[model samples]
Target: MPAVTRERALEAAVELLGAEGVRALSHARVDERAGLPAGSTSNWFRTRRALLSGIVDWIAERERADLEPGAMPTISGIDELIEGMCVMADLQTGPFAARTRARYALFLELADDPELGEPLRRQRREFERWTERIVIALGIADPVPATRALMALGDGLLLHRLTVDPELDMRPAIARAVRALAS
Candidate 1:
């Protein structure tokens, strides 16, 4: 079992990351946000890298949980798949907005400093592989390339929506892509 303190610290890190950018992240901020003793976060994460790693772990687990049945995406059919795509594209504007922003915050930082993105990329690859499975299960003839296409499209949609238009609704386009892939 994971240590409760570590989890608490990571959760606080998520909140801090969401509320502020990565520049604001530090042992002291996390400890204060988590309501822990001054040195508690430092005990768990001796360095900034370790702290980031923990946040990545927490995000992976949290996103996976959010993907469970009855949660976001709610994948069951093509329509649900479309909803899932839209949900992800719309991640920056809801109750989970802060965490969504936090995830992107990491992505922004990693873009400039690629090394720090290893864990983030690993988590993303896992999701892409899962998407590959879903595409294959749908009887798509070209599952590998199809998975790449879908992921790219989803990523593009998310990035565009977040940066260009917060109200941008690409569900129709996403649905069209799904139909094209299925056909």
Candidate 2:
């Protein structure tokens, strides 16, 4: 049998975690989910910790790709930023919902492990920097804190939409928050 690629294993792991929760994630489960040989996933990721680490790395890569130039609308002001963010909110709960769910599941599962959680933290920090640049361009007096606040609000809204109310309209809330932060 051909050796299973790391990407294939991580993709299956994300699907399993997103659909069935963290408890359903295992080397054997990933192998079965990926339709590979019995030990394919284990061959690539010998331990659960290693497997999870690889998953986070893969998630970060995918998100970064999504944010690459031309992938997102150019942000020039508060209004444009809000529009872009609302679009992101839609993507988070729509097309990429499974990836969002998997990310949250991993966040909760690895909260106490700084080592395992560092990749997630790093990803968030990178996002913060990107948002900070936008907020600064919007002429916010204190862009750093405002950027943090906006990101936290967005995360909260996405979580609520995902876990509590699927019908939630996040645009108005995001718009208000962006306006307040920018002002």
Candidate 3:
């Protein structure tokens, strides 16, 4: 077999996180998942933290792409903005829900570890920037407040979904929050 490239290894890492949670994402496990030799991942990443940083960057890029221009459009008015946010919430609460939860759990784990905290903090900042852009595009007069509210709402909804019925439709809950914010 050919050598496992960085991208391939990161992809395997993301899938492994989705399948077996963050604890299963060591260099050795990623190497095994990618069908590479024992030391291949270490050769590329040097350490588990390095590999995790790469994985976090990869996932952030993917999520940013998914939320960009066409995927997440700004609306003309408050009603439309609410609708758009509802759709965004639905997207998170739907097929990608498990991955989101897994990512958040990994984030929490990183938060407790000093070595990983900076990278996770950087990721959160990037996400906040993205949310600010979305809020501005949505035509909110003060995007920062709306952005903060939306972030809170999104986090709360995700936590609720994870703790309660994973199958619960989040549209109504999100719609209510969006309307409250847009008003």
Candidate 4:
């Protein structure tokens, strides 16, 4: 069995957030969802801020793993780069779906509280850096502009899937968008 830890509790919280939205979150709820003994989650996350931070940490950890040195696909050109984008889309619709929903819910929460925004701000910077590298590898003259564009596009596609089109095929669409970036 997986060892019980703070991270484990956070993962359960992510699932709870996805399944029941932000209102369902609580130390007791997390412990119940995580299958730990009563009071376990509260022991790890003593306050709402601590729990939100843990959720943010969980999102950040998954994102980091997705873009880690060895996990990333090699980008020889626009095609490969688009493939990577498709991969990102695949993640949102696949195993990461719940986490993605939980992240959006957290995004909304962050807007109402600056104190809870640090992890999100840092995560955005890291994602931007990753996008910048992809833009540079694509031989784009201005990485910042292209990176912003691609990030927006990906976000839009993801948002659409999460809210409007559950069956949307993001690969071909992302390929087209990335190809435009190369042109």
Output the number of the lDDT-best candidate: 2
* Winning candidate number (TM-score): 2
Winner on TM-score between 2 and 3 is: 2
Each model's TM-score? 0.76, 0.92, 0.75, 0.91
Backbone clashes for every candidate come to 0, 0, 0, 0
- TM-score-based ranking, best first? 2, 4, 1, 3
lDDT of 4: 0.83
- Compared to the true structure, candidate 4 yields what TM-score? 0.91
Superposition TM-score, candidate 3 onto the true structure = 0.75
lDDT tens string, model 4, 1-183?
334567679889999998889999999989888888898887877898888987887788888787788887877788788888888787886789889889888888788786676677678889899779878876887788878988988988998998899899888778887777777
Off by over 4 Å in 4: 1-3
To one decimal, what is the Cα RMSD in angstroms of model 2 from the true structure?
Answer: 1.7
lDDT of each: 0.79, 0.88, 0.73, 0.83
lDDT of 3 by residue, 1-183 (tens): 234477778777877886688777789888898887788878878987788777777777777677567876656666665676667666666766655765786787677776655655666677788877756776666788888887888788777766687776767777777677656
Candidate 3: which pairs clash? none
Query: Which digits, one per residue and each the tens of the lDDT, describe model 2 over residues 1-183?
Result: 343466778888998998899999999999888887799888878899889988988888898888788986889977889889999999999988889999999999999999988888888888889889888988987988898889899999999999999999998899888888766
Model 2 misplacement above 4 A = 1-4
Model with the higher TM-score, candidate 1 or 4: 4
Ranking by lDDT: 2, 4, 1, 3
